[model samples]
Target: MALRSVKFMTRPFQHNSNRSIEIFLGTMNEGNYLNVGLGGSTQTIHPDDAKRLRDELIKLYPLALAPAAAPASKFKAGDKVTYKAIVGYGARGMDGRKGVIKDVLANEWYMVNFTGGPFDNLIKVHSDYLAAQPVEPRGFKVGDKVRRTTGQSKGVVMTVVETHPTQARGDIRVDGMTGWRMQKYFELVTDDPVEAVKAAIPTVNSGRYLVVALEGANYVPGSKPKVHVTDIGANAEAERLAKEVGGTFHVFKATFEASREKPVIPPVKTTKL
Candidate 1:
């Protein structure tokens, strides 16, 4: 007996510009596989098997894209979505990572899922990150109060428009309504307020903060020392503190450093009398 390995013969079918269907051979042996490859590599399989696999793949593929779709109605602005990157077979890529849908974009592009370092981990994805999740309706109605999970606005639901398949879009009238046009958003809101509230919190970067100490002529021990801040999150608060204490602030370009395995010390400054 010879060792056997199943080979896949894929037939690509274009379904519009955004979607595609592929029919694959159920199984092919090495002899047939090579022969088929030599003749332009296109091989046919049992129509019934092909259709079955195609249908099964269609359903499974969507589930991989949006696991929350199982209970999509339970999704909201702040809900965390677990997105597994769909890499071509045999391609190297990250898989099973998670992100939060900060907002929804046109054509099912939900801005969700992020991964990187503390300041560098920004991952945005589409509705593909979510699968239908279970949801129960809240007593929320039009004109009810709601707050944005991200961004600078909190407001009431202006109106609710129902769409096909139990999906609906809500128009939120935020404080001052600065961007009312962009206020219409989609959420998988359920009747359960606790679940809704839990989903609305954005994913957090749970990394350690980097602290650097500087020593100089004007430096005092814990006297509101002024220091320069750098990297992605080095912001107004850091600059303000540096100015208040009259210390030199120098920002570095790196976002993260290695763990406490090695101690880093700043260069000593010498003054001649």
Candidate 2:
């Protein structure tokens, strides 16, 4: 028999945006082998019951997006949701579309009633394909420094509002734009003034003698003000750092030897007491 193939619609092969499975018929030799394409790879199977196999794959189309061990539903009835990048069937171009979760199902699946713009019906979608409506981030608080994971966009969190019980999303002011952003889009940025100041100072060696380092009168205070010590050859780096920071440092000469010195009391001469 000549090789005959029938291409089926694309389905999610894995929980990734760039990966999918394209089901189709493959070469039918004497043994009748069919090929299933999965994430840029192919698997050959001899199906005694082709109809049954196709039915099983159809049922598993959405579940394949979630792990084998499904997680508990993070959403509940009446929760607002939006489609994630990986959508099923005709869900393409449905970004930013709003939907209401009617019911949460077993195996990380959800029954959502989508509204408006190619979404006038209910869809049984997987949890991986749905995202809760934007709310304040659960971990972020007011006055947190955040920067975008992708580009140079960064801002301080100004407002955080709770819209759902599962998680919170926050608003940030980045590049003169203020709006609620996804928590996963940004990361926290931290800085330690003390560590920064220490890094600015040069490394120096304490000569065989006593070495003392004095901070500049104009030294910028760190989170904690304290002395720092390091080894510098010939005090070269120390001198440069002192000059740059308008500070002064000195190296004293001393002798190292074993001594058993004892404190002596002075004799006091007393008159008539």
* Top candidate (TM-score): 2
Alpha-carbon error at 99 in model 1, in Å?
Answer: 23
**Residue-level lDDT tens digits of model 2 in 62-141:** 45565576565789999999887753454677666789999888887889898877438788988777888987545655
For model 1, how does the per-residue alpha-carbon lDDT over 78-101 read when each residue is reduced to its tens digit?
776655555553213434454566
Candidate 1 error regions (>4 Å): 1-145, 151-172, 179-190, 196-204, 210-273
| Model 2 poorest ten-residue lDDT run | 156-165
Clashes of 2: 12
